[model samples]
Target chain A: MFVRNILSAIIISVAPVSSVLAAGGDTPPIPSQDWSFSGPFGTYDKAALQRGYKIYREVCASCHSMKRVRFRNLEALGYNEDQIKAIAAEYSVEDGPNEDGDMFERAALPSDAFISPFPNDNAAKAANGGAFPPDLSLMTKARANGSNYVHALMTGYKDKLPHGVELSDGQYWNTYFTGNKIAMAPPLMDESISYEDGTIETLDQYAKDISHFLTWAADPYMEERKRTGFKVILFLLIFAGVMYGVKRRIWSNIH
Target chain B: MSNAPREKFDNTVVEWVDSRLPIFTMMKNEYGVFPTPRNFNWFWNFGAIAMFMLITMIATGIVLAMHYTADTKLAFDSVERIMRDVNGGWLIRYIHMNGASFFFIAVYIHIFRGMYYGSYKAPRELLWILGVIIFLLMMATAFIGYVLPWGQMSLWGATVITNLFSAIPFVGESIVTLLWGGFSIDNPTLTRFFALHYLLPFVIVGVVLLHIWALHVTGSNNPLGLEPKSKKDTLPFHPYYTSKDFFGIIVFIIFYAIFIFYMPDALGHPDNYIPANPLVTPPHIVPEWYFLPFYAILRAVTFNMNIYMLAGLGLLAVFMVEFIWRHKPKYLNGFLGFLLLVLGSGLAVFGLLADLNQGWEIPMSAANLAPISAKFGGVLAMFGSIGLLVILPWLDNHPIRSARFRPLFRIFMIIFTISVFILGYAGSQAADKVYFMEFNNTMLAQIFTGFYFMFFLIILPLLSRFEKGRELPKSINEAVLSKAQKAGA
Candidate 1:
């Protein structure tokens, strides 16, 4: 019955409001992709890689939990363990028992998974305002446009509305991400982080790389996916050739 | 001739700096040489100022957010924690709060500067239009950001504004509910507000990029208002403009710092000090100071029957002045231009004065009876602004070629100045309710508002036909510059 009701509502809304919704423009992609990080032919962009790392350190690591990844794993992404440890030690986590036998918080270890700073979901939601900003572990994949949408959204605000909504004195509206207008104030900034890569600190470059890092976090198996795809394609090509030869032999004999 | 050929040498320091810190090289590729006017001017600096505010607000906002709570129950306490407990958190919060005020201040100036200089005209229309877009986004972001603290003003303000959408035809209620995330402004609204507040600055940043790009494409109009003629007429963007913009930024920062540090709450509502109570509404809910002008405009219209007309008229009037005042460039001699300077300055001064004292009592009759009424200063100032702007082209009537004498244009400028002073004086008066009620009509209000609209829409366009030719001086620069300087002084 609920399904029927929902379907009926959708039909009703669409039949009348399609003109309104479709009038402004088509519904944008669910999660937009950032193509800058992934270069032509799926090559990793070095500048994007460095920027991605910077975004991780400056933004994501503050509140979000990447439970599957380790600080030390950054070394594989090309950071030295010393660099990784220095970054990890920036945050203190709860661990060993206190003198009263309660667990105590301490500096995060290179070995530790990226635990959320909040105590629990309730704490997170309470701090953020009743909405537990979801762990962005698989956010890139979960979102519609992959990484591009995130990058574009970061810098997409204008002062005026395209429609009737009136903003208060200090509020701004971003166009790229969902919500038509969003609340997550633009996070990335030019010269916000001191980059090691000598790339000029540009908001675009920063957003692009951070988005790339998030994309990787969401699907750590991206490289594997690409590899598997290539192998399957190669296998299919060889199989097609063999089948063609076999069919020719059979046909020749029959003739 | 071989005294020993001197060994060719490369400066390693220069190379190293170029490789390691290529700020200049990158700048060259993107913006070209220092002072590159290849096109811009003082009007172009606002985007940079806007960018600086975005960064300042975001940084302070994140810090505040770190200490803030989003739940309906604890959101107020969390704001208190920011004010009372966190180290330098109060300062950050206040700066963020006031930074919002200053951001609007800069934007209004930026917008007005665009208006006077014709920054939105022609090829640069997109830039001006994009600026409007940026302004809209800024408003949304600020509104949601204000609500996140969940203070009294945040709550009541949200209720009032959210309820406004219910005026829409049909699905208004549902739309409002969807916006609120519920029937009333509560947990869901707070959450959604936070999510959106967090998001909009990035959008502003995006539009700003487009704004600058549009400006770059249009280049910038010069102080002389004459298009650049040659390579000799242009300069590298670095030392010339970079230095000038840097100077502007410094001066702006000094003022910004005063507000951020000392008078932080001066622009904020006193009611916000109290915690939000959904059941209670503040006695006189007013938006921030930056929005006061528009609020005044909104309040000026007594009848809901003409709401859309009033609103549209007010908005369209903002850009109407430029068109009305627009005249053939050839006819705008130094003397005539000087008159415009005087009128423009007077209008600005009056606007500021009108905005300042919201509740000053004005004496009305022979009995010397003074009573407090809602200030009509904004209305009067706008009235003056409308008159001057709409009839500008007619007032500065000069034929296409005659630049030698600008007596007619000068007379128009004086007329514009006198009208502005009269309108400004009238604007300072409190709205007379006795007169308003006894009249039993909005005819007086309409007369003022209508004249404001008509001057631009009717008078100025009509004046274009009567304008005769004027003779030009040897140069567009010397004739206008000296005159403007004299008028400004």
Candidate 2:
């Protein structure tokens, strides 16, 4: 009876789908892609992380700021402390007031957040034609189907608008974007950044890499979370088994 | 009480402590040798599981609170900080988040088990009522906790639900303002919500204590719906049921770990990741999945009372005709029953179709006479759905306790379950527009909402009179013996 009821319920719930097909026209479906860190045992691919960091530095970093991540955090992506120090030193960051009580610029330390190109939200908006460049810190978590949406938007730019549609001046057509028009133009091109590890530098590879890097930025503890979860579950199984044995021994004389 | 002899401490220190506090005596009385029906199956394990979940949530919640900021501007960032900066904070937050979901899951199963076995009958009525009270406190706690995240759903959900008070008559506006701590959900609202969210769980803990005390007073209802007649029919709660509860907890924790580790966001709304934006309303706004059935009931009230009056009158006519034709009511039901059924079905179909089209056009004269607006009706419907549960112990007047013996009651139970699922599905749909069918989602919601109330208020009481229940086993021992004999054969 339970199975039958469940089956009937499923049928009733699913029966309306055919009638609602037209309702889905508003937002285009997001395409799915495989990730190295997709499952319980999955971990970040270190080589991709390095290439992704390079692509971010060369292309996207000028527009987007990963304000939540410090230069030292690059160690998680396989960078040594000296390399991190060198990278941080390459960028000049605003520092505290001197004896004159005025702000001054100094080479950034590894602890400093990746610097923003624009000073503030207003400046970012002004530079981008009224569209503020969003901070990249939690971008992977901010949208639905986050990584897929990011990858799709990067690769979805079209050379021509769909037949009847026309774009206003700065709007670029990207089929995956909500309105199929976006303020940011296509940021990646073929061979945009040469990887130090000799990996191919295709546009798709750059988009995927950056997506992976952003995902890590959003959830750096994914590896630890899965690891701890596995251990806890294993311990619980053994503990429960022991508890069952104790219970049997205690009740052995009864009933 | 169990026949097992109570253990006596021989040591002087143990005796002295026992004389002072009697803590061991209380524990021995309440848990060590407390008699429990041996016939209880896996379903009975949820109460223990729920208690464990409560502790897990409270423990995790206290730690999370230490690092959390209640200020609106920082609330969102603080949560992000907890996830990114604090050591082991992600695990704590995930446990709390997924814990809320699991808590509801366990409680729902627990409530359904009570309903299935007639556990709320007779001496256990107060126990059932206390459970209902706990359920209400839980809903309130979950609602405010959802807002503490300061996400899009949090802000907008706060606005929508707090505004529900505006359905009241004269002081509605003031009540909403008072609740919000201002004209809108803002800094004070977030601070107060955080305070209340922190406080209510402790309140729930208190009520849970009273609930358990009541449970102990009445003892547990077994699957057979028979009280133990002798000690042989029961087992000590300690050693036996405690081990069972431990096993249940481990199993439940495994399920929780899957959500926390593998698919943390599976139960969460994606829009919640975005910080609250008052200017941009989400395309569709829905509450957490646990609240869907009630949310759907609220949205279902799209039409005024004309439809309800018509349907009520039609049902009354059917009942009257059946009453007059008493002896041969079954054969007399064909033509009129078919006609009335079609009329009822047509009214429902029209209501849903009209809701899809927008709303039913109420005649100007009838509009004022319509006791309340549809919005207010929706609020009443939502609250009424929970309120109906309080009276369930009385509504069910069956001689037999468990549905195992009541074939007709079992059918109604199935219908009740289906209606709830339908309401949940409707609730999950976008509230602004109808989808999936030509009929409006609100209209479908209303139809299911009608079934939900009817199951409790009408079907349960009415069916109890007509149902000829099957024979039930006289005692738990007999039931167990028969099962064993069948297995041996």
Candidate 3:
């Protein structure tokens, strides 16, 4: 009954709003996929997030950076401490000045932020022909309809330019991007990154996995939050119900 | 017994303090036996709920300030650190983030309750005015608090809003600079906003104390807009209303928890998650959801001043001069009327000169013709929206409180509510976004803005003069017992 009531409420609030609040009139509608962590009671699928991390490391990491995510945070994806340490050691990060008073690099610790491909935004922009690679730590959050939008951009590339459309050097056409123009080339394809768990290795699978992964990355506390929310709301509901009874009892003689 | 001077407590500690300070006596007099109208509905819950949100915000904000770094370079990263590293910091920050929206929600419902019940009339006027003051303070607090995160929207929104100060004519640029603490919105601006954001809520609390004092003075205006007459018409403040308010607050928290836990960023703009970068502004910079209606008003007035506006103002000069001189309908005639007529004609002259100034390019930059005047006009309209609420008690003195008895007013109230909601929706869309033929969001906002002002300025006065209200109940007792009987209780 609790779940049923919550389901009705979620439907009441979400159904009409999603249909009506579609913004940016010129942009194409981003088709939403079933996300593991979509609702109030939903929790992230850890294995999917781990698979997404693989796709990110193999394909997108060369350009984008996850500046806010720490190596230790990957534990949320079911990594043990040793495994997290091993993952941390795989990438090096900038450290402090030593006896020589010069900044140096060392093997990364679990506490360190994700390593960046480019040292600075200026260098990244110069390398990419004046197009700076944005940080992806908040990418799924920093845009409206972020998860669907990113997924569409991943698989949205047009093989041939649509009628009279032309690209200027690096500019690529993506079906879902605002104005249909994007700076980066198509980043994923069939077998973009193979999964050992026997997950399908198609472009669609790759996009969905990464989208799931990025969603987890953006809000790592989803599982804990929803779990806590269930208990909190349940308690409040009971408390309110009992309080109403008490109020009735107190006011029984008022009339 | 309800109005008795004192009741001895069992504990000597209380008796000693009571003898010295009489605070215990004060509490008992003010709250313990205070007679509140027993006919309160769901709407009465909002006032206490609004107070609950205020305390919640303050509690969360104080904790957030502890972990926050005020510098421009560190502010965004510090917030991330709070989210990632500090234990339960995400919960605190998200509560504070979504708390502002919820705070506005409660307060808006509270204000609308006042409007629907005509709670602003007579002895409750100061109570309503205090509420409007608290509301203004809340807006300032929320706007400055938005800048504390130092995100793209924060920076750009700060820049745009502070630039509004430049519309002050001679001291405009200086005021903007003073607000920014520099030529641009940078570190100094961020730091100062943090300081002011922290300060404004306490100011709101002070005004809220005054608000509560005023409410206690005249007592709560119920849904029926009737004051409690005697014991039968009222309930004591102990287990009865306290129990009800607690239930209301907990239910409110349930919704707040849903936002904080599941969709924390739903009410917020995605651009805000991006750190502040002044050089590249977001393509569309919208204020937080609560500010949308006023933002729509501001944007709607972006058209050039023309002959039509001049003629409209020239016609409405009488309304302006009349609004300035008289507070009530009776005061609208005689010496005040004759004096206002002369002043009204003078304002028409000023309106003609203003029309002439549009073409001639006046020395006052804000008053200058063309685009700036329109922008300035937008700014005026936006402020006037709230400003009108401050004087609403005088504007509508339709003897009968509550729209339940006044059929015409009930219709006007519904229309006014609908228009505000429409204005809110129009504001949420892109200014140039057109859903139909020839009419864009800006034009939609414009028509509704006119409707919004007209409801207050023209409709209320007209209703006061002509509309005969239905019979009021003999008292709150008569209404409640009848309501119970109709329900077959």
What's the TM-score of every candidate structure? 0.48, 0.89, 0.90
Q: What is the alpha-carbon interface RMSD for each candidate?
A: 30.0, 10.5, 14.4
Worst 10 residues of 1 chain A by lDDT: A1-10
DockQ scores for all predicted structures: 0.01, 0.29, 0.30
Top model by DockQ, which number?
A: 3
- Arrange candidates, best TM-score first: 3, 2, 1
Clashes per candidate, residues 3 or more apart or on different chains? 72, 0, 0
TM-score of the B chain in model 2?
0.88
CAPRI accuracy category, model 3? acceptable
- Model 1 lDDT per residue over B393-464, tens place: 334342331222434433543454344344333332223322544552123443445455454455434444
Which residue pairs collide, candidate 2?
none
Best by TM-score: 3
Q: Write the per-residue lDDT of candidate 1 for residues A1-255, one digit (tens) a residue.
A: 122122123213333454454444333554445463353136455456657867876776666666555676565476787888987898788796877889887899898877676778688767654544556655554444547766777667666677776655434577764345454555777888778768778887777777777766654444533454455445555654564455345334211
Ranking by DockQ: 3, 2, 1
- Better structure of 2 and 3 per DockQ: 3
Kindly provide the TM-score of model 1 when superposed on the true structure, using C-alpha atoms.
0.48
